[model samples]
Target: MSLLQEADRNHLINEFQALTEPVKLVMFTQEMECQYCRETRMISEEVAELSDKISVEVYDFVRDQEIVEHYNIDKIPAIAIVRGGQKPKDYGIRFYGIPSGYEFSSLIENIMMVSRGESGLSAETKAWAANLQEPVHLQVFVTPTCPYCPQAVIMAHQLAMESEFITADMVEAIEFPQLSNKYQVHGVPRTVINESTHMEGAAPEPILLGKLQEAVA
Candidate 1:
């Protein structure tokens, strides 16, 4: 069975027609004890079929230690978007779970951003991200059904796209219950910055930037 509907596939093909550069979706998954790992890889492959410029690479999380370490992937069902070229280009954009529901849109947007090599951020946010001296990790916790979660996830991803030192991940809270409990996530759109600062709900760019600033400060 196809993960995407026929209408969705046509829309995605049209969207991917704008790609001028190649985009690679690197997925990591283990064979055993990993829920949704297969589905994650399946969706990535399905999406890759839409565009000639897009490709998917599936790796075993347990066996591909070197590749996993190279990409800084620490979990199963993880994805890394890389711009294909002669030079090394990893914008540190990642998804830590199956990007279903509203999060699916984020995955498409990320592909476009990687293909264009642009963050699509405001001047203020871009300036802030460019000047960052410290590393920041953003984990946005979301459920598959939350309509507002995509905004939070996309904002953090944009920041990651703008700054090399920032790594952003969209974590599906329902898929990883232990992680959700560890972070004490009781609501959707909860963005945890550097594992300390927490912003609940869909925050705008400036507010998110302010939180990022606070995390480094």
Candidate 2:
């Protein structure tokens, strides 16, 4: 069964026409695919089928420990958006759970962003990232049902694209209960900066940059 509908596939084909470079969607799953793990892989494969510029690589979370460690992947059903080639170029943009619902848009957008090698961030945000001295990890906790979640996820991902020191992840709260509880993610679109400061709701680029500034300071 196709995870994507006919109309959506057509739309994606047109959207993907803008791609100038190749993209690799490296997905991690175990033998006994965890909750939504199978669907996540299916989604990656389906999306990759839409464009010749895109490809999918599936890896076992347990069996592929070396590649898993290299990518810094610690969980199942994770998707890493990277530039495609013999040597995959990683930008540290990741989806910690299935990029379904609104977050699906985030996945697609990140693919395009990676292909173009541009962050689409404001000048100020780019400037801040250029001077960042410490590594920043952003985990945007979200639910598939949340309409506003993609904005937060996209902004964090843009930061990751802009800075080598910044890594961003979109975490589905329901899919990862322990992680959500650890961060006390009681609200959707909660952006966690450096595992410390957290902001609720879909924050704009300036606010995110300001928060990032605080995290590294």
Candidate 3:
């Protein structure tokens, strides 16, 4: 059975038709003990079929230890979206679970962002990201069902795409219960910055950038 409905498939095809460049989705999964690993891989494959401009590379979470370490992936069912084809650049954008529900929109948005090589950030935010010298990590916690989660995830990815020092991840809260508890993610769209500062909702660009700056400052 297809994971995407026919209407959704058609819409994605239309959306991907505007892709200016190829994009690659690097997925990490293992055959053993990983929940939704199979489904996640399937989702990547299915989405890739929608456009020739999109491709997928699957790596086993256990067997591909070196690659996993290179990507710094701490969990399975993880996906990294980068410029496709040769010499692809990692934007530090990641999805740490199945991009189902509202989060599916996030996957599509990041692909568009990567394909066009555009962050669509504010001028001030872009300038700030360009001058960033230290590393910053952002983890946006979400559930598949959360309507506002995609906005938060997409904003984090925008910063990641703009700044070399930034790495942003969209973590599915329900799948990773222990990690959710670690961050005390009592609500959806909670963004944990550098393990210290945090944002509680789909903040606007300026506010989100402020949180990012606060984390590094």
Candidate 4:
């Protein structure tokens, strides 16, 4: 059976109609013991088929050792979103694990962010993001239907794209429940910066930017 139903496909197509630029989703996987490798690839492919502005490229993790190294990917079922022919200035929002569950919305939001070049950040946040001097790592935990999750993930990803020193990831809450427990993720959209600081919920642009500045400072 097709991964996406016809009605769902049509809805996705309509949703993506606003996309004006190209968004490339590069997925890497191996046919070995990786549990979610196949499913991850399938999700990306199905989503890409919904829009002409979106394209999916699959790479064999084993055969493309160079890509594995170049992208610094250590896990299977990983995805990197690139814009145009260039590697986006952002960290490309790694999906180390499959973005199932609440993370499905994260995937869609990420594609939109890349396509529209828009973020949930304010002017002050944008200014802070532009002047990032040190590397910042953002890990956002989310579920697919969490209405507020995308706001945090988009802000982090935008900063990654705008600054050379930022990398943001939206991790599926269910897939990484252990991580959630470890980080005490009692709610959706819990963002951790540099593995040191954590913020929960959909914080506004200025507040999120302040958290980022605190991480780098």
Each prediction's whole-model lDDT (CA): 0.90, 0.92, 0.92, 0.79
In candidate 2, the residue pairs with backbone N, CA or C atoms under 3 Å apart (3 or more residues apart, or in different chains) clash, namely none
RMSD of 3: 1.0
The reply for model 1, stretches above 4 Å from the true place, is none
lDDT of 3 by residue, 184-210 (tens): 999999999999999999998989888
In TM-score terms, candidate 1 sits at 0.97
Report the CA-based lDDT of candidate 1 relative to the real structure: 0.90
User: How many angstroms is residue 14 displaced in model 4 relative to the true structure, after the best TM-score fit?
Assistant: 2.0
Clashing pairs in 3: none
lDDT of 3: 0.92
Error of 1 at 43 (Å): 0.3
Query: Compared with the true structure, what per-residue lDDT tens digits does model 4 show for residues 110-192?
Result: 88878877765667766777877777888888877787877777777777767667888877776776788988888888999
Q: For candidate 2, give the lDDT of residue 184.
A: 96
Where is model 2 more than 4 Å wrong at Cα?
none
Q: Give the TM-score comparing model 2 with the true structure, all chains together.
A: 0.97
| Residue 174 Cα positional deviation in candidate 2, in Å, after optimal superposition | 0.3
Query: Compared with the true structure, what per-residue lDDT tens digits does model 1 show for residues 1-217?
Result: 9989999999999989999889999999987838889888989999999999998989999998999999999887999988875654888999999998889998998999889888788999898888988899999999889999999988888888888899999999988899999999999999999989999999878888888888899
Model 3 error, position 140 (Å): 0.2
Model 4 collision count:
6
lDDT of 2 by residue, 1-217 (tens): 9999999999999999999889999999999999999999999999999999999999999999999999999887999999987656788999999999999999998999999988889899899898887899999999999999999999989899888899999999998999989999899999999888999999877877788788788
